[model samples]
Target: MARRKTREEIKTQDKWNIEKMYPDNASAEKDLKESVSDAEKYGKYKGHLADSAESLADALIESDRIEQKLERAFVYSRMKLDEDNRAAEQQALYSKAAAAISQVSSLTSFVMPELIRIPEETLKQFIEDEPRLQTYRHLLDSAMRQKDHVLSEKEENILAQLGEVLSAPDQVFTMLNDADMKFGKIKDEEGKETELTHGNYISFMRSQNRQVRKDAYTHCYEAYKGMINTISANYSANVKTDVISARLRNYPSARAAALSSGRIPESVYDNLIDSVHSALPKMYEYVKLRKKLLGLDELKMYDIYVPLVKLPKKKIRFQQAVEIGKEGLAPLGDAYLQQFQKGIDSRWIDIYETEGKTSGAYSFGSYDSDPYVLMNFDSTLEDVFTLVHEMGHSMNSWLTRKTQPYVYGGHSIFTAEVASTVNETLLMKHLLKTESDPEMKKYILNMYLDAFKGTLFRQTMFAEFEKKTHEYAENGGGLTADWMNKTYDELNTEYFGPALSHDDYIQYEWARIPHFYNSFYVYQYATGYSAANAIADRILNGGEKERDDYLKFLSLGSSDYPVELLKVAGVDMSQREPVDRAMKVFSGLVDEFAELMEE
Candidate 1:
């Protein structure tokens, strides 16, 4: 193995040109000061929002400006900090930016309640009275729609002040998982001492060496098991916070409060869970096939990630991955393709991992800035897929920023994953159609199957766990470690079926999942994957109309509701058809993989 490069050693072309957001720290600080001043001045209109249509429109526009500025400063500082978290100065900059944002949010906190206080007819008249306010119609309407849920001004202010306190659970969970928990070390298949970490745990689980996989799994979970009590307390606090916050806001349930943010109907969440339940037999068939393919009498959870067929060794370079992604996403048309290429050429990506760099990949930027991606690129097929995935988000942001106003320029998390997963689906289709080598074909097919298993099935399992835990807390039950563990274990058994054996430590897996801190967020992964598959299929086979509609969806941002936007792209997520279609895709992939293995 080669030594990893430092941030300075990586080529300039491969790193994101975040200097576009700010030329230097000095410039960033300058903007931060300006933003604070602007926000302070903007606060003058807080109590005067309902004074007139012009007053309301002016406040909204100024608020938008301040937010856009804050986002640029914040993204730059945060990305700088992420590049090397150990740098104290970068950390300070990030902290300052965060504080500035919180200040602005605090200043503007009264805007919504004040607007909501206006009569519904008066607010509509305001929109009609001021043509300029027409640009904010959706924004104003969204606030008005929350009328039933909006509390009094004093209560809203109190909630705003408690924001930091409310976030304690997530903050504590992050510290424990990322900064404090230690997984120790284990010997790898190569007989080298390897450090066990959250980052590489999944890779170890996928090892062909069963003993190595089992050791890594046991050791990793053992660490979590040790911290189980503390983690459970923290998570329980998080659940209680969710329940209390929902009740305060008059939402019937925490899940309803969560889903309502993106205007998603509770039916969509229930439909996903129900549809997944109906598809368990297909998942069971896949598991049984895994057991037979591995020639094992019993399949363990650790055995789930190993590839069914050994793929030919093919190392894909960063540039090669970019070319492959471009080909895969070409169906979206030339303009979209050009935008993607521009992002690549303009140093919109930060490639290669360095010491202290953040783990994993993400696409982020402000409305005024170019959509940027951060990646720790290693030359593997997985890395290639991730490249396309982040690119999907980047392109979506790019299109939305270009087309929508600042207020609606960003998308919700509900629709965010759809863009990224669609890219992965298309990439898989491209590889399978073009690759002739049997082993390589099997490899890509297996990757597709694993994606479904992980994203669709595994996340749905997580979704179920989140729902149950929240329900338990809502019913006046305590979320003790044992209760969470037993509930998780039962769900694991139910989802994976009798074909797989669960290890004892596997029951504590919930303690290790960071997503649990974000209330009811994982369900989007399942629904978004399903929606992506349906949209990708249409774009690939349904011709120009489909491609145009999908592109239109990407440009929509928050202009319309997520489900409605998806419908425009030919995927109605409210119904069960999309989930069923995705399961059929999963079933077909399993059949193909089993047949290919026999050959």
Candidate 2:
């Protein structure tokens, strides 16, 4: 049996094979030099772009080519570091590539503002006059879309220069959390011990012993308590970054600015939060019943993940997880299913748990090749869900690339989670029906309910917290630790209701969530889950037309904004219907589970 790997072993595995990115150090150096030369070429075209339509088209094409190369280098470097964090050489290479990207961005920043300055009618004429320029019409239109937010070149340069320092809060927190922090051993009921680290916390939380779950939660927070102030400062700085950026861009609020990035309307955010809020009573009822099922005197956060039903010793190996995933996804039709099988056969997935291996799971790739998924498999129920989730991302990339051009190959993050979560919903439904064992069916149902609660309700709470903080900062409210805790505590009370006690340590959760620092981002997880559940229902059970619509949505890439794409996918998130439908699903699950328990 393969046990967890040590950091040293992981580093030695040559797991990433980053040379596949650039061939060797020499090739990387050559690319770096070529990119710098490309930067110079783009720089020369900056102010002189009004020569002619064809000239403008050629210049824009060259700039995109330069960007594509730089992007590839960055992807390769970043993936290497993720594969094995302890590799010094790969880290150094990533650093170099990062610096190169910054340099390239600075050189090309002049392109957009200058393009926006061109009269819209004149630009349209350019497109009409030059057939070659039509290919770039969307790119030009997107640049023009930001005309309201564009600043003078000098102001933009100042923001660029401040980027590193401004982003310090997130950077310092990442270093402290991912690299430094450590929690001591957690002792289970039988006295067996496991070291508590970020990567292993999930595994420990699933422990059968109630004491083990409580200890892991307490110890993990205890470790974070000492660094609470530092984390708080980091979060506050992030809030401030959004405020300052939004103010500079002349936006009404930071939330507006973030939504505008993907052309999302603020109504989408509000609708999701409002819809989820109305459904909290159902969620609370589920929790109360869960506590009763566990036979606990009172419920704490630690009780959430304990299995409601136990299977009779089914051990899903990492390989078996892949097979199950492929089988579960096969209903999407043969083309979608075949690529996933190819992904498994090609070893596109880096499977198994090892010390220092990255925690969580993700699928990432450039337009250059097949997508790769990184997972630390512990053969647990959640791991299977994660496999399906990441595969959703990978398969989305695969299908999108096949159907769209290189420029539009990637979809926005707003819609990305829907693809992943939809796969998970389908997988759970498939499992519930196919598994004849009553216990297994119940377990699968529990898993499905847990997904909705965790992904939708929990994340919406974070989203509400995020929106409040941004508004507070934008309105001249201080982002001090005290302010954050007070705001978060109130939101917790509102969402969780009075049945359960809100602990002081829960306040520190705002400090620990990495997503907040990324700004106005967590809400997508909530919205996406809702959107996915609705869309997945149609795709799975609504027959041929729904399936074709879903495939078209996947193939959309960036052809339209997220809202437009989702509308085509049969979920108009701009309206509140999807949110209401999803919450209704949550309520239905609670009712069904409660009835089953009564029987």
State which candidate has the highest TM-score: 1
How well is each residue in 338-361 modelled by candidate 1, as lDDT tens digits? 888889999999988776676778
Instruction: Go through the candidates in order and give each one's C-alpha lDDT.
Output: 0.87, 0.78
Model 1 CA deviation exceeding 4 Å by range: 1-5
The worst-scoring run of ten residues by lDDT in candidate 1 lies at 171-180
Q: RMSD of each candidate?
A: 1.9, 2.3
lDDT of 2 by residue, 262-352 (tens): 8999998998888988898887788788878888777777777777775554568776887888777766888888878777766667665
Regions more than 4 Å wrong, model 2: 1-4, 7-18, 24-26, 188-190
Clashing pairs in 2: 5-354, 5-355
> RMSD, model 2, all Cα superposed?
2.3
